[model samples]
Target: MSSLAVRRISECFVKPQFSNQICNLTPWDIVMLSTNYIQKGLLFKKPATLIDEHHFIQNLLEKLKHSLSLTLFHFYPLSGRLVTHKTQNPPSYTVSIDCNNSDGARFIHATLDMTIADILSPFDVPPIVQSFFDHHKAVNHDGHTVPLLSIQVTELVDGVFIGCSMNHSVGDGTSYWNFFNTWSQIFQAQSQSENHEYDVPISRQPIHNRWFPHNCSPPISLPFKHHDEFIWRSETPLLRERFFHFSAESIAKLKAKANSESNTTKISAFQSLSALVWRSITRARSPPSDQKTTCRLAANNRSRMKPPVAEEYFGNCVHAVSAETTTGELLENGIGWAAWKLHVAVTDLNDRVVLEFLEGWLDSPFIIQMGRYFDPYSLLIGSSPRFNMYGCEFGMGKAVASRSGYANKFDGKVSSYPGREGGGSIDLEVCLSPQTMSALESDQEFMNAVTEFDPLLF
Candidate 1:
C-alpha cells in the first residue's frame, strides 16, 4: 500500500457546560486501576446526497462537539480525572472534576486522503489505521492532568472514522457503549433541530451508585514502580491483525456440532466461536504436544452480583475466567471439548464467587503479574457479541462498520462485536504474530468456516 499522510486541523479540550464535581471511585473501579484503557471506533460511508462536502463535514464536527457537551451533563465522570490520595490509609483515591483545569474530553479533527476501499480492499486492517489511535500518550502528564475520555475524528475521502478511548478504571464495555449510544442519541436529536431533547430523561440516565457486599473494606492501591512501561517484552515478534466474519448460519452449524457430542444442552454462539478460534490459534502456533495453553475470558459480573446490579449502573464489573488444557488434548479431541471448557468457566460464575473475589481484592490489591497482553502461550478475549455496536447512529445513518482501534497493539488478543445485520451473526478482530497469522490463513479447517468481512454482506 502507498504511504498516506494525515494533517491535524484542530485540537481543543471540551469541558462540561454544567457544574463540576468530584465522584468517588468505587471498588469496581479500583479493580481496573492498572489495566490499559479500552479503544472503540466506528466507520461510516459519506452521505450520497450531499452537494457540498466541506459544509457537510463542518456541520458534522460541530454537531458532535455540541452533543458531547450535553452528554457530559448526564455522564459527568467522563470529564473527570483520577486522583490518588497521598497520606490517607490504604491511599484512598477518587475521580475528581476540578474547575481550574482543562478538565474535559479531548476533541481532535484530522484529515486523511484515504478512502474506505483502501482499508477494506485487502480484507485486512491497514497499518495506517494505527495512527488513528492516541496510543495512550502522556496519560500521566505530571501525575495531575489525565483525561478519562478522548475522541478523534478522521475525515476520509469517501467516509468518516470516529475513534474513542475511555479509561477502564471508570467503566467496563457496557458502560462505555452506554455513553457512546447516548451521545449518538443526543447528536441525532441535534441533527433534526430538536435541541430541547439534549436533557436526557431521568429514566435513561446512568446510575452511579457503586454496589458492594456488606462489610466491604477499602481496596489498597497496588504499587508499580514503572507503570508507564509497556507490559509486553521488547523482543516480542512482529504481529499482524485480521478481521473474520461468521454468518448466522455458520454459527448455528457450529453450535450443532458442539452439542452433538453430548446430545444434551447446546453451547452458545460465544462458546462455539471461542472454541473454533482457540483451536485454530493453538494449531497455528504449533506448540509442543506436552505444553499447556490458556484462554482468558472477560466475564461480566453485573448479573452475577447478589440481587443483580441495574443495567445502567456504571463502572468496571468484569472478572477474568481462564480455561486451560494441553495442546495434545485440545487438538486430539474435537471442538466440542474446547467449547465445553469455555461453557464451564462462565457457568461457574455466581454471586458467592463474585463476592469472595471482591473481598479478596480489598484484603490484598496486588496487581497480579502474568504474561503480556499478547503472550504466545496465552490468549485473551475482550468484548462480547451482546454489545450492539452497529446500532450507534449519529443522524447521518448507522455505522457501516465498527471495530476496536487498539486490537493490533498486542498479539493473541481477540475482540468480538455484534454483526451489522443484527441476527445473531458475529465479527471477530484477531491479532497474532505475522508468522502465526500466515499459518492460520493457510489452515484449511480454520479457513473453511471463516469469511472475509464485507459490510454489504452483513
Candidate 2:
C-alpha cells in the first residue's frame, strides 16, 4: 500500500463519427478562451468481490474505450482541437474548433494501487491527492495549442477514478454533464450487451450555433487579448482546501430559516445553502466591519435565453452574478437577508439581461476584473445544485463521490456538487487561506451545519 503509484497503460484517440469541418466559437465561448478548463472527476468504491484483478481491469478498459468512441460519434466537437485564425480585416483572431479527426480526444489508461478509503477519508483533500489529475490538465498553455478535451481512467485497488478535462471555451457545465451522462448511458449499454439501446436521437444531440451579440448602441469588440494565466498563481498567502458535507436535513433547516423572513418569495435550497456558506465564510474571515465583501456565483443561462436555447446547446452558456455587501451587513442581516440578495440577483438574469451581458462582454472583455482568488473579500462559487453529479453511473456502480480537480488551487473558491446520497444534499469543496480555514474549523455555527461524510453510513 505504501508503494502505491500511477502507471500509464495505454494512450489512444477517440475520433468523432464525422470530421473535416470547422466550428466557430460563440461570443460566450470567446470570453472564456483565457479561463481555466473545467475538471469533473468521480471516485468509485471497489466492488465487494473480484474474481480476478487483471481480468476485471481489462474488461473495464475495453468497455470504457469502446463506449467513449461511440460517445464521440454524438459529441464530435470534444474530439476536435481548438485553433485560432487571424483575419486580415480588423486584425482580429477567431478561435474555432477544427474537427479534423486527426487530433481526436485523448484517452489515457492508468492504474494506481490506492484504496478509496485512503484518499476520501479525513475530509480535507491532501495536496498529493490532486496529483491524480496532474497528467491531463486542460489549460490553454500556448496561444492555441492543446487538445480540446482529455480523459483519464485510473484503476485503484478498491475502486476506479474517471476524470475528464474539457476546455471552457467549447463547453459549459450543462454540456459537461450532457457528455458525461450520455457517455455513462453508452458505457452501461455496452455492459448490458444486446438488452440496451444505443441510439441517441438527432433532436437530442447538441446544437452548436454560436450566440452572437444583437444590436447595441455601440458595436462590441469581436476578439480581445487576454492573458493566459490563472488568477491565484502569485498569491502571497498559503491556500488550504477542504470539503464540507451538508446533509439534506441540515439544508432543509437552513432553507426554512432563509424563507421565514420573506413572505412573498420562497428562497430555494441552493440560495439558502449558499447564503449560509457565504455568511459562515465571511464570519470566519473576520475582516474589518467596513470591508466590502462579495460572492460571485456562476449562473447558467441556457433556460434564461429568449425562447430558451435547445435542450442540448453546446458551448459556454454561463455568466457570473455577483452579490455584494459589507462584511458587517452580511453578518448582521442574517441568512435570510443574504439569501434574498442571492435569489434576486439570480432571478434578474432574464433573456434581456443575458443579451445585455453579451453586449457588455463585447464592449470590453476585460471590464470584469475577476481576480477574486487573491482578494480576501471575494468568494467565488462554482457549480450548481441541479446538476445530477452522483447519478453518473458508469457500469460498475454509482459513484461514491465526485469533485473538481481545479477547485483546490483557488483560494476562497467554493465548488458545489450533489451529495452522493442525494435528496437535495450538497458537498462543497471550499478553498481558503490557512488562517481563515482554521477559523472556520473552530466556528461552532458553521461546524454544526456540516455532517461528516461516510459511505458506509449510506
Residue pair clashes in candidate 1: none
Q: After superposition, how far is residue 238 of candidate 1 from its true place, in Å?
A: 2.0
59-149, model 2: which lDDT tens digit per residue? Answer: 8877788788788887877877766555557676456777873567778888886778777776577554554553233343221566677
Q: List the candidates' TM-scores in order.
A: 0.91, 0.91
RMSD of each: 3.0, 3.2
Clashes of each: 0, 1
Q: What is the lDDT of candidate 2?
A: 0.74
Compared with the true structure, model 1 gives a TM-score of 0.91
RMSD of 2: 3.2
Please write out the lDDT profile of model 1 over residues 1-458, one tens digit for every residue: 46677767997778767646655555666545445567788988889898999999998998889888888778877787765444456443333333335458888898889988787767568877766755343222222356778888899888888988887767889999889888887777777765555465533678876665687633334443344432322332466888888888888888888878646475787898899889999999999988899888889898888798877888778888888999999899888889999888888989888888877866765442223344577788889889868878875588888766642246788888888887898888888888889998988877887755578432
C-alpha lDDT values of all predictions? 0.74, 0.74
Q: Could you tell me how far off, in angstroms, the CA of residue 370 lies in candidate 2 after the best superposition?
A: 5.5
